[model samples]
Target chain A: MPTAPAGTLYRGREGMWSWVAHRVTGVSIFFFLLVHVLDTSLVRVSPEAYNAVIGTYQTPIMGLGEAGLVAAIVFHAFNGLRIALVDFWSEGARYQRVMLWVVLGLLVVTMAGFLPRHLMNVFGAE
Target chain B: MTAVLENSTDTSGSESQAGAVSSFQVTLKIRRYNPEVASEPYWEEHTVTAHGTDRVLDALHKIKWELDGSLTFRRSCAHGVCGSDAMRINGRNRLACKTLLKDINPDKPITVEAIKGLPVLKDLVVDMEPFFASYREIMPFLITSGNEPSRENIQSQADRDRFDDTTKCILCAACTSSCPVFWTDGQYFGPAAIVNAHRFIFDSRDQGGTQRLEVLNDKEGVWRCRTTFNCTEACPRGIEVTKAIQEVKRAMITRAF
Candidate 1:
């Protein structure tokens, strides 16, 4: 085998960066889904047990973590839609850079709307 | 004719611009590597006077012929048909013979390097054995059953047009090397190999579609493609490479159903 340099850092454009972000967000969502499923399944045991477990999620740290999860979900969903459009639409490849900016813009707008309300719930005294 | 030439030259003596082509200095920052001499690759810059219409290959040729005798690169047709001069120009994969000096911002220093994800053999030459190996694995040729046709294999215009775009491929590694998946993972079949598979898979006369689909069903085969559009952007032949790969994936899914 001819030995050559390995792991040369490739500088890719918006499409490549979108691919990397998609994969990263996908893996994070998968792990988060696993824990979510396990926690949601606890409702089968008793109502109080499920309520107690759900109450723990109201903490400020969990609020911030949930915000991160929401960001991941938003990015994954929007980017996945962009990938699908690029795959199916004939002219999608030509307008991909434009689509990436649109996805980013939508993500920022949606996160801005959700974060403040979610944080208020976490830090507010009830 | 001599009198006519003298008259024309005298008539336009101050403003004659018939065959006068302007040339400007352009710097080519080429990546150089020699395993026998140095363990690592290094940058070498050469400034050459070239016309605006000159291709990047012409600049390299000028540098080799005038400045340095040892500056090496590969070329055959000096046109884009041979697919021998595919390299990274200004951080993008393009054919040196097709990319003109002025098209890629010649005002700044132009960067010339070998295609990514391939082992560099020398300056601007990469080992193509691995790339060809993947091409061969996809069974690129037409595989028909039964006896050979007596005269010619007849097909309708629509049938021939089905796989026409992929036939334009010159086996250039530009699309494959530009793929981020192929850069990170060497085992992936890459877009070019899958595009070749798509050519035969969608062929109306080919009977090897099932076998090719089975070959690409592996983990490192067509499934590894992330549809990043890099391959489509890098293809010198302008083939819709990502769409062809997607067609193969769709074919596989249809087969499963």
Candidate 2:
């Protein structure tokens, strides 16, 4: 048997790309949740300690990071719904491409609406 | 190689040239590999003249018989029943015998390669041992309890219809190889294995549904499927592969509850 390489280079379409995105977002969200829980648990220690930890999230860098997290959540939610529909509905599989585009449209619209408001809250005069 | 018309005239014994056979040269860009000669697979081109209705299998036969003797592939019951000629055609897994040259863009060279995710034993033939091993692990056959009835096991039409689509699977491995998860992680049972499991699991006569579900409940089971739909698209038998996998997942969930 002749072996060119261990793994062949495969080009994936929208479905495959969506699955990759879903997994990536899932793992990112899991880690984000872990950090969120740890930071939230600081309130039990003391207000000063919680505030000190929360102060780091008030930075411009953290604001941009929050935006990326919001985008990941939006994509994961929309794509997760699409996967659910595909699993339950008989006709959902046929319109998967349409559903993906719809999810993308919704994601963009959501980010457009959310980013400005979120950034203003993060960088607003206090 | 350039396209050459081998037999431009109608050879079907039609005296009237009204529907004369039009022969055009087709270039097959086949991936060739010989362990004795080459360490890696390389592209080999062969130009064979074929009619509009000729399939990729016919072109391969023409190349093997006339152009190159060392060219190797598998084909049995060339009309697509035997499922021996499943390979990647133009980046999509398809049956070579079922794929018509005219259906694909004949002006361009048709690319033929072995199915992905499986080790190729020769030119287009892959080692199906791993694929069948997974299939066997799922226990594709019926496992009924109690004494065997003297008469045939009666099954309602609807009960039979529950698994009708999965019965179309010919163990071609097209759906399995097309799966990205299976390609990335070989431990995953793949779509074909799950589809086979669905067949027996849903069978009314089968008493092994619980055991089969337990087998698939492993870390590398149906949970690994991301519903990419590549298996559904790549299935040459038109089986609802993703749907079957989903049904199995639903069964697992139902059992859990």
Candidate 3:
């Protein structure tokens, strides 16, 4: 287990961390897409069966899961855009930390908006 | 005559040592070949006097000037910019003049050899025609469909800043030589060429992004990079070579959308 990185970091940069997060989010979104495709394909079984599966997704508990999915998608999209910017642009490295904070901020804000709706559905009458 | 005089001067002790500061003994185990003489290449040792400040280029010059005039090697500019002096010194590819004695080894002898993964032309010079052919096949220049600039074409400073880092490549083939895929598959667009492609693909003034991406989307294109980061490590100009390749990959995926 050679844990040693081959090169020194460039002034405590977060580019590597952002890169790892992008990969994780990419894989998560891919699996979610797969399950989404299968779930939508439930119409082949019957309209009733498909509605039941669709109905399960609208519940308060499922809303929390949906919120997590939204969080993953938001984080992935924002960070992916940052990576694309860094790749295409020259001064991309200079704003790498700023991009990280921006992505995190966007994730927090998206989760905040989703959680209120999710809790209202779960607790009722609020 | 100079060698004979210097040999006898060594007998005078301290005076010779002081005067000999301009030259010091070094053993060069150079790889040699002759169509008229040997069946295969063989090692030939030549003891040459080189200054301490002298690089491997100086040692080869000693061999060519004093010892054997028949020895062949390639050198131009006598500086690092030309990239013509690339050779394997002590089992690593680098420019001869760029490698100083203090950097390699001051005491032990230095081994000088031809650049690897290329056909040998003579002694130290390898054929770079194949290397250049790959570079040309990648279309290293900007190709645009838009009308020529009437005056100075307008592009935002921010857009110009996007591709500025990728434009610093000197086409030295240092990154290509340091790549493992280029060593295995000659058809693969190695890091240097792909970096150059990226330079134009992201350029705001360039309208040939689709055409260049079509060329790079081939099987032997940017996908061949295993993300080993060796090319990035070997880049002399400090280009983020892996990051450029990853950008091309991202473009391939996003363009699908």
Question: How well does candidate 1 score on lDDT at residue B138?
Answer: 94
* TM-score pick, better of 1 and 3: 1
Compared with the true structure, all predictions reach lDDT values of 0.86, 0.87, 0.72
Q: What is candidate 1's DockQ? A: 0.32
**Candidate 1 has which clashing residue pairs, if any?**
none
For residues A1-126, could you state the per-residue lDDT of candidate 3 as single tens digits?
Answer: 111111111211255456556777789889999989998899998989899988877776777777777888999898878766665665564466687799899889888888787777766774
Please give the ranking of all candidate structures by DockQ, highest first, separated by commas. Answer: 2, 1, 3
Q: List, residue by residue over B1-257, the lDDT tens digit for candidate 1.
A: 01112223344565564654456779999888888899888889999877767899999998998899888888899889989999889888899999999898898999888888888888888899889999999999999999978988888999989899899998879999999888768789989899899899989989999999999999999989888888888889999888888888878988788
Best by lDDT: 2
Best-to-worst order by TM-score is 1, 2, 3
Which segments of model 1 are wrong by more than 4 Å? A3-11, A27-68, A84-102, A119-126, B1-14
**How many collisions per candidate?**
0, 0, 2
After aligning candidate 2 to the native by TM-score, how far in Å is the CA of B10 from where it should be? 12
Query: lDDT per residue, candidate 2, B170-225, as tens digits?
Result: 98898998888887688899999999999999999889999999999999999998
Can you give the lDDT of residue B12 in candidate 2?
67
Give the Cα error of residue B66 in candidate 3, in Å.
Answer: 1.9
Candidate maximizing TM-score: 1
Error of 2 at A16 (Å): 1.6
Better of 1 and 3 by DockQ: 1
